[model samples]
Target: MAGVQDQLEIKFRLTDGSDIGPKSFPTAASVATLKETVLAQWPKEKENGPRTVKDVKLISAGRILENSRTIGECRSPLCDVPGGVTTMHVVVQPPSTEKDKKAAHLPKQNKCVCVIL
Candidate 1:
């Protein structure tokens, strides 16, 4: 038991209908860090793929995993196979930025109030 490894292997179900390998990582790996690895392995040709970590969300068991959660803590939500391999779904969202805050043009009109003396 001294040298036993609690390695967790997971596969990512990309939005593009592609699958990533059952990559191995320590059970202690944070969800935040795992996103980076997924980003690295993401296909460059994925036009709608995430451009940054903030643009991606990792979900398991119909819940979005927080950045602070350890991979071990998330194991329960996933379906573990005989080999302990699990799969997670990826959701890509557009990053929130000033671009989204642009104001829309409104038609200019003036109204005058009439008072009868």
Candidate 2:
């Protein structure tokens, strides 16, 4: 077991305008586990939003964190993050609704078309 110093206090900034934690998690914890914690604590709402891990992206220091990496592997040792409290940004990518899908496939008008007299 690691000592208290090894534990990292992390806060999440969710896309739904929700902020979760300043919670302590072992630095050894995998990014996948971190995502799970965020998803669990994510606010439940009627509005459509990211419903699975695949729909969400967690970014730290301008880099999207990979699920396979451990906090310690990304932080200490590798030294990506500093000691003490840290905040990460979460992006929710909800699957597009059918209406949006239809619009995307529609042909876009060319803005620079020349009129033939």
- Per TM-score, the best of the predicted structures is 1
Q: Which stretches of candidate 1 lie over 4 Å from their true place?
A: 1-5, 97-99, 102-117
RMSD, every candidate, angstroms: 6.6, 3.9
What is the number of backbone collisions in each predicted candidate, taken in the order shown? 0, 0
- Writing each residue's lDDT as its tens digit, candidate 2 over 32-97 gives 888888878876762555677777788887788999998877663343344567778888777778
Query: What's the distance in Å from true for residue 109, model 1?
Result: 19
> lDDT scores for all predictions?
0.80, 0.78
TM-score of each: 0.75, 0.69
Local distance difference test, candidate 2: 0.78
Runs off by more than 4 Å, candidate 2: 76-83, 96-117
